[model samples]
Target: MSQKVERYYVPAQSPWPIVGAVALGMIAVGAGNYVASLPDGGGYSGYLLLAGIALLLYMLVGWFRNVIDESMSGLYSAQMDRSFKQGMAWFIFSEVMFFFAFFGALFYARMLAVPWLGGAGNNAMTHEVLWPTFEAVWPLVSTPGGTTTEAMGWGGLPLYNTIILVISSITLHVAHTSLEQDKRKPLTIWLGITILLGLAFLTLQVEEYIHAYREMGLMLSSGIYGNTFFLLTGFHGLHVTLGTIMLIVMFFRVAKGHFTPANHFGFQASSWYWHFVDVVWLCLFVFVYVL
Candidate 1:
């Protein structure tokens, strides 16, 4: 006699999901409008924006909880596991594209925009008539508009942060290894330490940003240099913030016995995301700060 295989399926109907979609749609539109209306000092629509965000987050939690329950109940089949893994891969690819767009911008600024502004190519008059003191450089410590800022050196807080993030990456990998080998205590300890390192990195980043603005006069609106600097690292910082939240969630799950050596896609996905963010920061440090 052969064992009959059964497939797991969640019925394709959830009213809460539709509600969440509408809520998120509303929040996006309302938030844009609220920001636009800020100059006029009017709009209670911001409240709608807030409510929508709250509702959307609630919906996400409920939906994920339902899925988690279904999975833990052994309802998921090998087919479902493959689907989940593929979905995660696609999500990571999308994230890579997002970062690529910014990286493209960084390259364009360094290769074209800065040089053109300093009177390269067709802008000979631009060089002779203005910004004669400018030099083509990355991170662009000074701008044609006369705003100057000290480029962060790799020797100080930035170097230390680099070391911390790199160590965190190593720790995350260690956690993954231990989880695979069924070493729960080491996995948890390493993961917890990784989370702490992430937090420390964020704290140091905040301090660096403050120091740049207050002591070095670097600001977002100062010039193209400042604009690119803040835009690149600032967006990376946002990703770090989000990755940290994911890690925190994983920590809770780890402590509550959520994942297993064989069934821990959530942990793996988070680790991948965290590593992606870490690598991006290293590029930013090398290109936008150290270089």
Candidate 2:
């Protein structure tokens, strides 16, 4: 018997893509203008940003709903699943490169720029001529331009958040194991715990930011240290938030008995993303906090 040739699943043309593109464009423009206006009076960019976020959320809900419907209807073949896996792999790889750029910047600043500015290497003359009082230091307490700010310590909130995230990842993994074993209750409980841990971690992060700004005087303008600290931690927190939301969706799907052990690509993808975020946080804890 000859093997039957199945046709590839081709989704109908949809307006969601264009809508998503426009929403992202608006968000980019709004974010740029909002940052620019922060030093002065607030501008319309804030409203535009809100609008863009709302539109993006709307688009995401619709897109995800359509995908879920198609998946549930069994419109997806093995080839489609392979395609999704490949697409997700590329997406994660791209994300790795995105973070690499920031990490490279952190490395350059610590290894080269700071030392060069503090009268090291061939730039001793440059430092002497530009900033005679400058001194190179990790967790830079003072900038070359004389801005002083207290350093965020790794003892309390950061340590707690790290534990929370590490445990969350483990819990998510256990949830996956439970799903594979066809134990729905344990799966639901573990997934819920993971989501709660994520929420608590985010709360502590916000508290840490408040402490940094109010008590430590560590605002974004507090020099390169503050800038890098906020940029890294802030973005990580955003990822955690997104991961939490994805898990929430997964939880609902689990309740509806959507995923089978043999066919749980959605759950697997979300779990992979959550694990990735956790790994990134570990790196942040080591380099951005401990070091």
Highest TM-score, which number?
Answer: 2
Alpha-carbon runs more than 4 Å astray in model 2? 39-41
Please, what are the lDDT tens digits per residue for candidate 1 over residues 158-227?
8888899899999999999999998889988999999999999999989989998899887775566776
Candidate 1: stretches off by over 4 Å? 1-8, 11-60, 128-135, 141-146
Q: All predictions: root-mean-square deviation over Cα? A: 3.6, 1.4
Model 1, position 125, has a per-residue lDDT of 74
Lowest summed lDDT window (length 10), candidate 1: 33-42
Instruction: Give one digit per residue, the lDDT tens place, for model 2 in 263-290.
Output: 9999999999999999999999998999
Clash number by candidate, in order: 0, 0
